[model samples]
Target: MPKTIIPFGPQHPVLPEPLHFSLTVEDEIVQEAIPGFGYVHRGLEKLCEIKDIHKMIQVVERVCGICSKIHALCYCEGIEQMMGVEVPPRAKYLRTIWSELHRMHSHLLWLGLFADSFGFESLFYHFWRIREKILDINEKTAGNRIIVSVNILGGVKRDLSTEDQKWILAELKEIENKLEEVKDTLFKDYTISKRTKGKGILSAEEALYLGAVGPVLRASGVAQDCRQLQYAAFSELDFEPVIAQEGDSFARMQVRYFELFQSIDLIRQALSKIPEGPISVKVKGYPEGENVFRVEQPRGEVFYYFKANGSKFLDRLRIRTPTFANVPALAKMLTGIELADVPVVILSIDPCISCTER
Candidate 1:
């Protein structure tokens, strides 16, 4: 069969970010896929040199809108470590609640987009509609929906009052019930399973070899999660990384679906055990050393490295986003799959080109 070169994205309806993949296909089966970047690349990392560490937190938060809090949290934790500042216990618990809520919002966004990729319009609408509730929660607690600049260097900028905590728990209960109602349609529906199951297989070996992270890695049966590092308040709460063995597109989706519930449970647990105290602490000096922090993003593990020279500005800052690590695995998964399945397969990784290109 003659081979054909097809461009998959940069502006494809299914892609939420600008990721261009040139797929070589013969008889609809992809023979090879070459990914190209830079369309939406923002040189945010380079800005650390000009922006003070305090201001850089805001810049880092913009790395990806969906996972903004995680990015800011990781950056703050690294800076705090270098400065020898310990976050308050109450702040730690608050971080966990917001982090889990961030995860929930991100997964819901991806779930809707993934469904839309495969032509499940109803599922897409349903997921996004429920996600609006999460956005409302963000606004009520953090004062903004998308960026939610609540994380600061010493700790958090916002506090959940008694009334606020009660409201959050009530909202989470409603979200949980809605998630249960949609579980069957998302996982067991013929349309979803038929297209996703047994498609875009990424064996455990390939996933690890390619450095895949997040739901992509978890779906491959890897129990690795940065949250297991017990950062923030995760140690205080009961937590477990969701794992799936199939390593297919459906498995990836399933992992995220189940994780939505897990995140909800985590928020509930954190709120119940939250200690009442100051939400932030005072930092006496500038960050003077090097430290690394990792957090479990909705996509996967996100790493932030910060090096300081006892100055207000950072000496070096580096970030390794999950999508960047998962690209090689995405290329591997795309090979040998039907071209028509490419969109679903790509969505399975929940690729965030902005995060990758940042």
Candidate 2:
């Protein structure tokens, strides 16, 4: 069979971000796939040198709109560690609550996009509708919907009041009920299963060798999650990593679908056990050394490296987003799959080119 090269992105109806993939196909089956980047670069990391460390918090939140709070959380925690500032207990719980809310919304957004990738338009709309509630919670509590700038160096800038917590819980309950209603369609629907099950199989070994993270790694039956690091109030919470053995598109969807409820449970746990105290602490000195921080984002583990020189501005800032780590696994999964299934498989990894290229 003669080989053909097909460009699969940079502007596809199914991709939420701009990601380009060179697909080499033989008789409509993918023989190899090479990913391309550099389509979206904001130079946010480079701005650290010019922007004050405090101002960079808002900048980091723009790394990826969907996982904004987690990015800011990772950056803030790294800076706080280097400065020897401990976050208040109440602030820690508040951070956890907001972080989980971000996670739920991100996953819901991905789920909706995933459904759309395979032509499930109604399912897509349904998922996004449920996601609006989570975004509303963010706007109500943190003062913004997507890029909620709630994280600060010492702790969180916003606090959830008693009435706010009650309202959030009530909203979450409704979201949970809505998710349950669509659970069958997401998992058992013939079309979804046909488009997802056993497609883009990335075995456990492939996942680790390719450095997969987040749902992509979990779907491969890896029980590793950065939340196990005990950051924020995760140390006080109890939950298990959602995993599946198939390591296919269906498995990836399953892991994310189940994680929606897990995030809700985490928010509930944090709110229930939240202690009363100041939301933020005063930092006394400038950071002088370098430190690394990792946080579980909706997509995967986001790594932040901070270098400081006892000055107001950071010397250097580096970020390793999960999409960058998962690109290799994506290429591996793409190989040996039918070209028609490309969109389904690509979206399965939940690529965020903005996060990757930034």
Candidate 3:
């Protein structure tokens, strides 16, 4: 059989991020997929040399717009650990609340895009509409819709008031109801199932071997989540990693779908048990040691490595994004799927090229 190589994206209608894949195809089925990157690389990590440690928070947030809060949180937490700062109890709960809200919005955005990938336009719009509520919550509470910039070195920059908490809970109830209405259409619809089920199947062993993270690893039944490490108020909350055995595109979608509700529940728990105190503590000195921190973002585990020299600038700031870890797994999943199924399968891991290239 003659082979053909197809270039899939750096730009495509279905891809929200810029990523290129050299897909070798025999007839309609993909034989091998070699990924190409560097389209949107901004050298974010390199900026740590020039930008002060405090300014790097805004820089890290730009690594990916969808889950910016998590990036900031990871960076701040790492720095705080090195500086030996104790975040106030209220600040920890506040950070957890905003982080989960970021998770909800990120998952909703991915769900909408996933629907669009399979030509479910109405479903896409429905998910995005629900996502707008989460964005609104970010804006009302943290002053930005996407990159909230609420996380600071020792804690959070903003605090949720009593009235704000009540209003947020009411809004979450509405979002939960909206999600219930679409549950059947997303999981039980014939078209969605046909497009997603059994497509891009990756085994649990393969997922771990390929270093998959976040929902991609969970969908393959590895039951690992950085949240289990209990950063922020996750230590005080209760939840389990959402997992499925199928390791297919549909399983990936299911993991993310269930995580939406889980994030909501986490927020509720944090707000209910939130203690009264200052949202942040005054920092007396600069970070001087080396530390590594990991946090569960909407997509997966984001790892941050910090090397400080007791100066205003960091010696090194290295970030290992979830998408970077999941890319090899994505390549593995793409090898045997049909060319027509490429978009959805690629989207299944929710590739964040900016994060990867950063």
Question: Candidate 1: where is the Cα deviation over 4 Å?
Answer: none
lDDT of 3 by residue, 72-164 (tens): 999998888887899999998898999899999989989999999999999999999999999999999988888899988888888888999
- TM for candidate 1 is 0.98
Candidates' TM-scores? 0.98, 0.99, 0.99
Candidate 2 residue pairs that clash: none
lDDT of 1 by residue, 122-228 (tens): 99999999999999999999999989899888999888889988998889889989998998887678988889999999999989988999899999999998998
lDDT of 2 by residue, 1-358 (tens): 9999999878888886788999999999999999888889888899988899889988888888889999998988888888778899999998899899889999999999999998999998999999999888888988888999998888888877899999999999999999999988877899988899999999998899989999999999999999999998899999999998999999999999999999989988888899998989988778998889999998998998888899898899999999999999999999999999999999999989999999
Query: Which 10-residue window of candidate 3 scores lowest in summed lDDT?
Result: 9-18
Give the true-structure RMSD of model 3.
0.8
Query: Residue 277, candidate 1: how far off, in angstroms?
Result: 1.0
TM-score of 2: 0.99
